[model samples]
Target: MPFDFPLIATIAAVFLLAGFVKGVIGLGLPTISVGLLSLVMAPAQAAALLIVPSVITNLQQMRPTATLLPLARRLWSMMLGVILGTLAAGGLIAGANAAGAAAALGAALVLYAAIGLIQVRFQVAPRHEAWAAPVVGGLTGMVTAATGVFVLPAVPYLQAIGLEKDALVQALGLSFLVSTLALALTLSGAGVFTWASVLTLVPALAGQVVGQWLRTRIDAVTFRRWFFAGLLALGAFLALRWLLA
Candidate 1:
């Protein structure tokens, strides 16, 4: 396939913005980039384009915070669920019926935003992590396979588990990193992921670094306001695409 410079430019721009969002917060690169890029490409292709950058950025976010062993031990069930769910649904991601998946992704985003905006915080006791992890992880994996975004149940579930702010952010990074790996493998198996797309890693990482730098100067509240608002709009756009399709 020829390297279409224009398309590459568009992708870089999208990743740049998406990376900034991640830098400002701790998530959103895959969600925002895949969601927006789908506007110009097929959902599967869009999802593939996000892989390299998402993996690197999430791993970068994950390394700096607390020890990984304990957190991973606690979250193992959920991670297992994520892998299983993703593998099972690989066909849809690799196939042509992305309309439904995109719609589902859109609905999920809107629902996630509504939940966050309403400030509904749930706390699952540590003792309950065993039973709860698999359920939430499984659901998140299923959603991720179909949509390339995995925040809904997992994020809320993490919040409910009562981790402190830094811990929560680190946990998010770890979860996303795991999801990205699972997602990438699933896509590769489905035969949609490509080496060409991996060329995007450098640009994406550059954007992520720039975003992180800028994050140091921004007000958290304002950043969040815009983030959710953007999410709401993106979700609506995706739903509209499905309705029209």
Candidate 2:
């Protein structure tokens, strides 16, 4: 846990890149950061370091609070399911050996990338949402607890339920915020949360600022394609490397 010069540099670089991705798409901070950091450290440790940055950055995404309450009310079942599922599976990653944790993280990244690349669209009828939301939420929470990434079924489910663009962004923020808080609690209970996690905030925040600035100049759609492609490669590398090791 000692932040030596090399380790500090690695953390700074990883967060900078991850933050940039999130700035452009309003997601990927935790996903990218945890995936990259797991290359050098245990997944549990990488996840611990991500807590502060993920919570803060996601909070920023939940802007224009005027519509927040209605979104929350609509998604409350899913949020509750996230909390329960996370709590139930809290020990999975922390209790795992380094190889197992790394492999799981890698697999999660690969799945996420595949989903993004496929760009599959699903429509959920309004009547079904009452039963569907919690199921998606619970699955997402279990995934979050295991891999420190929470965008799989949750993101797709949200998209399927039909929110406008702005509302979709805000909904993502809210869902992430809940997932993050729940993860933080579980990590803490597992004794994986470290005071050193706070040290990551400066570089992470700085990177997000730069990314947000660049977002205005770039074509996000093109960037997204490249991003998912890179993610797929990285995820494959990590999974293969550790599983074979």
Give me the overall lDDT of model 2.
0.87
TM-score to native of every candidate shown: 0.94, 0.96
- Residue pairs in collision within model 2: none
Question: Per-residue lDDT for 54-137 in model 1, tens only?
Answer: 878877877764567778888889889888887777667667777877787788888877776677879898888888999898
Please identify model 1 stretches exceeding 4 Å from their true place.
64-66
Error of 1 at 232 (Å): 0.8
Instruction: Give the number of the best model, judged by lDDT.
Output: 2
Q: What is the lDDT of residue 188 in candidate 2?
A: 96
Backbone steric clashes in candidate 2, count: 0
Q: Please list the Cα RMSD from the true structure of every candidate, rounded to 1 decimal place.
A: 1.6, 1.2
Error of 2 at 147 (Å): 0.8
